[model samples]
Target: MIKYLLNQSLLSMKKRYDYDVTYMQDILRTDLGAFMKFMAFQTMSTHKGNLPVEALYAARIRAIIWDDCGPCTQLIVNMAVEANVDSVLVKAIVDRDLEKLPSAISLVVRFTELVLAHNPEADELRQQIIELWGEKGLITIAYGICSTRVYPALKYTLGHGKTCSRVVLNDEPVVPKKNPQLVGSHHD
Candidate 1:
């Protein structure tokens, strides 16, 4: 029901949500666990303002997605590791002088905790992170800022401490199949 409702909401949002349904279904057939994680991660990122750096965190975090659990785990791990490297080192890998990854990743992990735990964790996490990240990293953050609820306020919100982007539902969740009684009631 939640999945259907969210899909309907996306449909109403002017063809902006363009996740490939068939591809997602295929993944659902193959490995449901990873699909659930990906879906949960995206869903948690969308509605919750608790996700730190709220906007940029989701954008950077979603840079990679895969069909396989192993690959998906590695992709998320890579995102985590990228957050720990120096810009010069990262620049060597991607041929760009990007310095935002470290801060973005750090905040994202912190945001993850905020989503799972709550405000107390967020406060402690924020305090510990105050000196590590600065204004530029915050400014460069762009993805998750304009989440689903905020989508309706784009024209007014844009350039006013808000962001605008395509909103995609994570993936359709799988309903476990229930076993059927053998045509009629069976005697024990």
Candidate 2:
């Protein structure tokens, strides 16, 4: 229902931004006002930065996971690619293989996770980030992580939240088949 409304809004905005909106249809359908606000903020954030784009993206990605926003998560995969985050790193993140990423990025992911979870270890993680990236860097990371968390919360509040089912390696999510025979592994 809301998805349908958001799609209508996107159709109107399509001329404004030259890109496919199909991946983001769910978000559009949920809340057009919030969607527009996010698009504006995303454009602004990407244009100016204290932290490296990849780090910002990593933080946002972690927040998206914390949000468990399926649509938002999938959308960020494309956004990260546009931001020049290496495809391999993005794949590692989607695959839950943080070990494959550089220590700095992986640390950012972990720290974001702790912060979102309100874990006591967040302070220690903050210190580590400060040592690695300095005061400005820490601030940049905080800004990115903090700012990125709002949308997902809003989505959840609106009851549009969804767990991501796709493991993004490229353009599409790898959705497993329900049938054991079709999926290649039988359940006991």
Candidate 3:
């Protein structure tokens, strides 16, 4: 829905991030070609269904990096799997408000995000689902997250969408202090 990196910039900047990579910050102020590609690769994912999501994600992400794809399917992938919904039918899901459907279903959305955000997010999702859906639920969540993360990232990278995502830094500014010994100690 939020098309283009301009708007996305505002949203992303408003949030606090955990790390600070120079290129991550540099990409935002400059052209999106490299930045978009980075995110598409970073956030990129693959579902593979009945197939391991990790493998699928790796391949999907690789395609964008190597083959180059678009973002339309990526958008669909981003939203569907979490709803326990099928991304292939994302265009015709009837109502696309699964985020507000019900906590029971909404949990899928949040859990899916965690999986992508955290490589091992599946562990937590599994633990939570163990009480209810049990082992099957955990596997399903892992698959969904992996599946969902791929396309959107791929699409953005390949050009399906036009959102530019960037990372900011919060750590102490690293000052390249001059080494007293290397400065003028020997200068007479």
Candidate 4:
């Protein structure tokens, strides 16, 4: 596990969160209360609406991949899986096989990529996003994508980032259909 050096003031914030602040919370709060509020806004703002959280998560995965923030990439991958995103969808995202994804979700990924790359074609993609997601949904998705990018720079600069986790990215089946220990073992 990556460890953050927290000071007395940060410790107080951690205590308020029941001493269970997330990795980003610990690091951002290290700066001061205002920075923590900024971080909070980025994460919480989009979550206030009924937008598809899975699509937002998918967009995040794509953004972090483009940013080459390994730890954030791995963290988002784990989160997507835990959120019960379809394994096939998660695999497609991890594999960067965008064509394998549904057009609706893949549109968000492509838009995020183009935006981060600052390609002029991103405007075209943004238009497409607006058509599919509506202006409000487009705004939500765009904000979510941009917001997620900030954490990678922070973690990478702070030396808290790691190479993307293979265990998290691997497409290997996480749950066994049958218990290996129970195979050929006597059971009532």
Which candidate should be chosen as best, given TM-score against the real structure?
4
Global lDDT of each candidate: 0.35, 0.65, 0.38, 0.62
Could you give candidate 1's per-residue lDDT for residues 15-69 as a string of tens digits? 3322223434443455667556646756633432333432343333332210111
CA error at residue 91 for candidate 4, angstroms? 1.3
TM-scores of all predicted structures? 0.25, 0.65, 0.32, 0.67
Clash pairs for candidate 1: 55-144, 55-145
- Model 2, residue 81: distance off in Å is 0.6
Candidate ranking under lDDT, highest first, comes to 2, 4, 3, 1
Collision count for each candidate, in order? 2, 3, 10, 0
lDDT for each residue of candidate 3 in 1-188, tens digit (9 for 90 to 100):
32355436545633422212233445545656766675665432322334333223322222222221223223333433443444323322212234433444434433443343343554665465556556655555555445444544544554443543221112212111122323332233
112 Cα displacement, candidate 4 (Å): 1.2
What are the runs in model 4 whose C-alpha is more than 4 Å off? 1-31, 42-50, 162-164, 167-188
Candidate 2, 121-186: lDDT as tens digits: 779889988898788888777777766666567556655555445545465663311212222221
Candidate 3 positional error at 7, Å? 34
Greater TM-score among 1 and 4 belongs to 4
Between candidates 2 and 4, the one scoring higher on lDDT is 2
Candidate number with the higher lDDT (1 or 3): 3
**Total residue pair clashes for candidate 1:** 2
Q: What is the C-alpha RMSD of each candidate to the true structure, in Å?
A: 17.7, 8.5, 17.6, 12.7
Single out the weakest 10-residue window by summed lDDT for candidate 3. Answer: 167-176
